[model samples]
Target chain A: MTDLYLQDWRAWTPHRETAGECRLDTREKPAGAAVPSMLRRRLNLLGRAVCDMLATLDSGADSIVLHASRHGDGERTLEMLYGLNDGEPLSPARFGLSVHNATVGVYSIASGNRRSQQAVAASGGEWAALMAEARGYLADGQPSVIIVFSDQPVPRRFAAYAPESSSAAVVLRLGRDPNPGARRLSETSVELELETATLQPLDIIDWLMDRRRVVACPLSRRSWQFPAVRP
Target chain B: MTTTALEHELKEMIIETLELEDVTPDDIDRDEPLFVEGLGLDSIDALELGLALQKRYGITLESEAESSRQHFANLKSLAALVESRRQK
Candidate 1:
């Protein structure tokens, strides 16, 4: 298992507390100062969500960025495809940001971060893969790594095939070398036994913020144990 | 449609199609450029606005690539282009 410090973290979701229908809103809401207006205007919902959390974490300029998303920019991808089907010329900005790592690129531009960045996605084992990637960065002697996991629900046409999905982002600033041998248990030591593979990153953020040392999330089979916090 | 009314409609279309929030048609200046300097739009907005205008005004810019750039210079130019084409 990877041993790393959860130095800081932040999470955001577009859903407002409401009794109305559950759906994705594509508006580019103001996230933070990390993204300037010129760049912010170009970001789609997923990019804005990712940047919102990243800004909150104050991610290091040198920290490696690992953006793991099961469905990266799903809505934009669908729009591009539909535009193609109708023989319409796609917007250059949409085409530019539709790539998997586009959000990470935007983050780099916003924060002036030139460190190594990687995009990871898997039908299963996404979190596990993210952990492995962070471990690799630490082993390479990097000071820290930022892992931003974001996802948006698949479009309605593909909703039938996908599990329940929503738009959310989680940014974690992790480090292995914590202040010259601090003996605190690493956050990586936490074990989450999840029943379903569909573990939303927001659940992990909630668990980290709560006072509880262990959590069996209500709507999920994910049971997490945080031995790092034990006195 | 009058130029003033068409300009208002263009502003609304720009805001809606661009997904711009906290902005209204009254906020847009008829003489201000829509790209880069005035409205701060980029090439992507130009493409989106072109599509919207084509659909709404039932006009085509197929034969006028160079003039299309001129038409998109500002709200007045865009309205003039739309009005000129709508009368045809």
Candidate 2:
């Protein structure tokens, strides 16, 4: 188990449009001004949330990207399916962007960051998987890794089983060096415990944003503790 | 619709269907390429445009792969395809 420092992070979600259903106190939609219109037009709600978080995070080409999503843009998949079922030609863009890693691909091209990218789809242990992946990058002696986790509620058809959440995105820049540059926000040490999982990364983001230290979140069958962040 | 009107409608359809908020019909060159270099559209856009054209014109694009590819080559080609099919 390695102690990872949380150099920087950002979270985003829709506020007004989803106020009735999604209770998360999220900010307004992301403008994604940096992204060209060509690619931005293709982004759905999930992709928009990710782009919003990325726009706020000061990431560079050197940073490794790790994207985690419980259910990636499920709504888009449903739309494509409906179109196909109706014997209508599916939009190639919609079909292409429905995949798990479509957001990652768009980010790479839009941000011009050719660094290695990883996409993780976890049914329950997503946070654990993301942390583990970041640890591997740190062990490789990389300076920093950008981990983005996002999820959106599935269509009404799957809502019974999945009970989708409002669209959300959390971006974390993990680094080995505790003393990050001027962009340094806070430092967190992650330790995976052997207990059953309970809390999630989104909960951790809220806690961290609220400046709450000493958080104990679960990872898979184990629990991890994030001690108070240091300057 | 006349050629100019058809071009205008096509542009509107492309923008609305593809969700290209920043682009207007006037911005499109009549004979400019639709995918990649000119409009920077990809295969996905092609599929979407094809579907949109089919629905708007009340016609089915021929399944001839190579000919269909040519019809989608640019706004001019797409316009021609729409015009011919609508007239037929």
Candidate 3:
């Protein structure tokens, strides 16, 4: 196991958007149109997000990357769905943006990234699932890098799934400094457990990534924060 | 499919993939160029269309092609390339 580390994290949102603005959006009211714009708001946001992340990570030219979002650009999908509901068929533009990889496409194009981006969605366990994937990359001997992203909830059509929580992004890295024992297929094994208390998977994710870590695991979540090394 | 049908399909795919915003299959001229003052595609469009073509058919575009400019000239040329490179 590589010594996993939280390299850093970055997030972006328009003044009108709320998938991520930190505590800027503290509304417990129902999520609705007033919520922040998630993906597809502005290409500038995509570039801004990626550029800021690169700086924060100190990522090299060849650093591998993975991004996770439960509803990748679902706000755009909701808009398209609403258009469809009005008996007005979706425009071709709407169709393109509706695809899950649209933002991924934008990121790749803007950054000129050569390595493939690991974009995955876990429906509910978005963060934990993505965290696991990031760890896999770390264990695989790649300079493990992961980016977790989520957007604000859509309109009332998705009311049950919403309290319009703000979106966030956290970037984790591993392998720069090797860990000892319980590291790999050799000597011993280490089990990495991430438990969250927030009702929303994203809420749990928010808890795990919060600077203060509102929730705590029995042992030291920070000590084990570094992955076991395979020395 | 006939050449015209292939061209139509290619146009649809372009409009769909590029998010051309206000374009339709009918809006595109069958023989119009797709790049450089035609459909006006840039590098990103090339990447997306290339991927879509590979999945739809089995012809993977050479990422480092020297003359992709001429290859993506327009819908007609793209249709021809797709037909000629159609997987056996």
- Among the numbered candidates, top DockQ falls to 2
Clashing pairs for predicted structure model 2, backbone only: A92-B44, A93-B44, A195-A221, A195-A222, A196-A221
* TM-scores, all models, native as reference: 0.75, 0.81, 0.51
- Candidate 3 stretches greater than 4 Å from native: A13-59, A176-211, A214-231, B1-34, B37-88
lDDT (Cα, tens digit) per residue for candidate 2, span A1-231: 455677777666652233342323265656766578898888875676676566556455556789988778788888889888998777777788888999988888888888889888877567768877988988888777888878766688889976436566778788877754323233244565645343344555555555454444344443344543444
Q: Please, what are the lDDT tens digits per residue for candidate 3 over residues A90-195?
A: 4444466557565555555444567767777664455555555766776877765645454555556786764455444444444444344212211122333644
The lDDT of model 3 is 0.54
Ranking by DockQ: 2, 1, 3
Q: What are the candidates' C-alpha RMSDs? A: 6.1, 5.0, 11.8
Report the lDDT tens digits of candidate 2 across residue range B1-88: 6888888888889889988878888888888888888878877777787777777787676655799889888878888888888733
Docking level of model 1: acceptable
Q: Can you give the DockQ of every candidate in the order shown?
A: 0.33, 0.73, 0.04
Pick by DockQ: 1 or 2, better one: 2
Poorest lDDT segment (10 consecutive residues) of candidate 3 chain A: A181-190
